[model samples]
Target: MKTFTVEEVAQHNKADDIWIIVDGKVFDVTKFLSEHPGGKKVLVKMAGKDATKKFKQFHNDAIMQRVGLPMQIGVIGAEKKEEAPKPVAAAAAAAAAPLTPGKLVSADEARFGDGFPYGDPNWYQDWNSPYYNESHMRLRKVIREFAEKELMPYCHEWSEAKAIPREVVKKVAQAGFLNAASGAGTNPSVASLLPYPLPAGIKHEEFDIFHEFICVDELARCGSGGLLWALQGGLSIALPPVMNFAPEPIKKKVVPECLAGEKFIALAITEPSAGSDVAGLKTSAEDKGDHFLLNGEKKWITQGAYADYYVVAARTGGAGMGGVSLLLVERAWEGVEARYMDVMGMWGSGTSYITFDDVKVPKTHLIGKLNEGFKYIMHNFNHERLGIVMQANRLARVCIEEAFTYSMKRKTFGVRLIDHPVIRNKLGHMIRQCEATHAWLENIMYQIKTLPEASQPARLGGPVALLKAQSTQTFEFCAREAAQIFGGLAYTRGGQGEKVERLYREVRAYAIPGGSEEIMLDLGIRQATKNFEKRSKI
Candidate 1:
């Protein structure tokens, strides 16, 4: 058992302090009298001495079980706070493209030291970050406002209760963000880029249009993971086929309601029978004169419960890939049923299992050509994967920030845990992963911004798919690491939710969503091969 000297204790504001070394671990017992799980008398006996002997005597494994886990034995001590560098407030820095116009620049600027170079690994400082556009700046202000004023106060409480008020949703809708990529009633002078949802065409505007990505970034930062996913998912559902193939009447009816936030839509491509193998789905929609009878059950549908319409996938042809088709299914129509699903995370996100039992959808709502839903769904998968990538990045960011905070406060061995080399390694590794994810995401964002909207996904499919798979995996890993770093605090969740706790469940969904990593990799490698072969042929 290790003991602290009186001179050493008094030097660090220790007056009538008692220190105990338990299981070869030293802890300041100053604040642990009542808080200690082993009862005050037991701890008070060896208040000023090392409690290892008594702890062993008291433990004997039987008492260990009674006192919970090893982590609950909280450590207390003095900590040397690292002064946080002042954030630059220059409006230019705030608005300037941090990376290619739609990317995130890590907040870890190493101006204070060598390792802190912006965003962890110091890998992306050389990469051209264009996230500094005017709209990017404006959106940042709006999102910050939303997070601090509108979302923050209630976030912890709401997150714990697993509920978010609908009024907040209405406010987000009114903010015109659900449709930021498309210009719909949005002030053109302020949000000129809104008209183009996916950054398709318009070379200069498209190249510089960073606002669209910022909308998702800031919204995710709003503390309510469920809300961000719901809103972002809705926007993503609005972007794909409607922008490229839907007729005017159909587009007008379906698109505006989403921007207005009155209606909801979800892309349903995965079937329980054929999860990632879209070509293997048994769900089919048969032509019935003026309509199609969509008979299928789409599992893990995000926003399934309340979606006004579904960007649904079904088999319409013979077999394999050629037979797939994407159709719009409105909940108002008969035979459409949605059942709320209890998922691991995103509790208020309204995910569900949807069944269209001979549901009739007008031919007008048919997306693209009858046998072309495969292309639409495939093309749309890129953006969906990118969206999931964004989620992964944000989850990593939350974990890093929370862990950094915890490290500074959590004490061990008479000093702050962050000051320990081993603890710093936890942060260092997570940071490296963070930088990698941000860099890859930004690179993809740049490509997505420049390509003509007509074929952006096809052009960047390989990289986007690979990054989506990697980023989600990264999210899951970081969440787990964070949980371990926080130890006991992460498991007991009665207050502000542990990010790892939320993300642990959330990240798993990402692995399965969009497409599984194994599928993403196989598909991405194939696309990449084709991309090179075509380039060589050209």
Candidate 2:
């Protein structure tokens, strides 16, 4: 925190004691000279001088925070104080004011992060939104801080390691995020079922879909699909079936441990022979007097290798969807096996190929009634698809934020990249798509919250399917465009374009999972056509 004049900094110009200033902060890079990826010569050239401009041309903020900050020695001058954000109470009061024809209602909510135009939601930039209130803003600040402090810094490391540390998982659970992740915002009944209090002191009575949305949005802002999937991908989808349909005794034993982060669980539906064709899955379970014998394989099961339990779908009777049954299978049970699978992306997610060779499952472990598993699986799709939609859209925005940051700092043809009309056009398309996708997601969330519980699946499934397709497509487009803007940096695994490179690799994961684009589009249109026919007198 000590201040130094530029002349004083320049005195340490020798390679043995080099110091440089970046963005008005002094860093002693004498020892880091050898460690520099660009080699020691680059640091030698910039030693004892302001390298802020040169630093930005090759690296982004992620590098400065993750690498340069550790070497920071002091500031160049008096530190500028950041203005405190407007209070949530004031924002709410402003939002409540009556609107008039010519005047704009400036809620002026305290902006989150750097004011990077559309880098965040409009509401994050002080725009008034009917959907959010004080609690939403409070939760947003808390979750964003949590993500930045706890998860963001280590995302790349975790992804490359192909596993998240056990301690980090425990930290998330202790923070009560695991319970929130499992609670589908569409289901109010979930409030009663949570084993832990909500984070940010959000009262159970006031917690709703938007709060859940904030959690998903903030978590995705970390910009690593592998890390996000490693953290919650399996738990969110697999735990719900157990929470909602498993026998009370099974729920009593399993739900608490999983929600507490003491154990892990995965949903096993996709087989080597089937992905979307659920009925064709060959996993079979046969009834015994007090147990069911389960035998078959489930491929591409997220978190399966680490899961202590699996909510498995197996054929219990004849054929097709009618024969399928969901059963809770313990990983420790005899003849159960899981091995990690090498995949193109989601490296930290622990994707696995699992086998059950005559494993005996207690009859009491059956989830809901026999032959009703198809309905249960279908019932979970809207929530699952919605989770995918939220993650995909936010990831798209990350591409925009990263690319925009790079464009402003990076020069091409002796001008910043933003000065080019073509680059601006690409940004315009990316921004429009991201914002549109977000608006649609919020609208869908509104419907999910407002609709009657019994009518939700039938009423919203088609729309949710369409939104999933839309979000994944938008994510792909943005990732590709961001890569183009970053050029060679996007091709590299780290540095200024690390996120764009990673996101480009992850595009297919979002598009193919939940449901493929082909299937989602067909399902969406077919459902809409049926609804149209039902309403028409023709």
Best candidate (score: lDDT): 2
Give lDDT tens digits, candidate 1, residues 1-538: 2344444433433334665555534456566567665467776566545555566432223233333233333333433356883343344244344544455545543111122233222222323444444344445555556555666455545665655676776567666555553333222332332323422112323324356555666566543467666665655754456666777677767665666666677777777788877889989989889988889898888787878878888888889989887887788888989988887878777778988897888888888898888887776667667777776777777777666766766677899878989878888888788778887787777776566777776678878878888887777777777887777766754322345566666777778777788988898899888988898995
Give the Å error, residue 523, model 1: 1.9
lDDT, residue 310, model 1: 81
- Candidate models: Cα lDDT each: 0.64, 0.85
Q: Tell me the number of clashing residue pairs for each predicted model.
A: 16, 0
Model 1 per-residue lDDT at 172: 71
Clashing pairs in 2: none
In angstroms, how far off is 493's CA in candidate 1? Answer: 2.3
Q: After superposition, how far is residue 486 of candidate 1 from its true place, in Å?
A: 0.9
Candidate 1 Cα deviation (angstroms), residue 474: 1.5
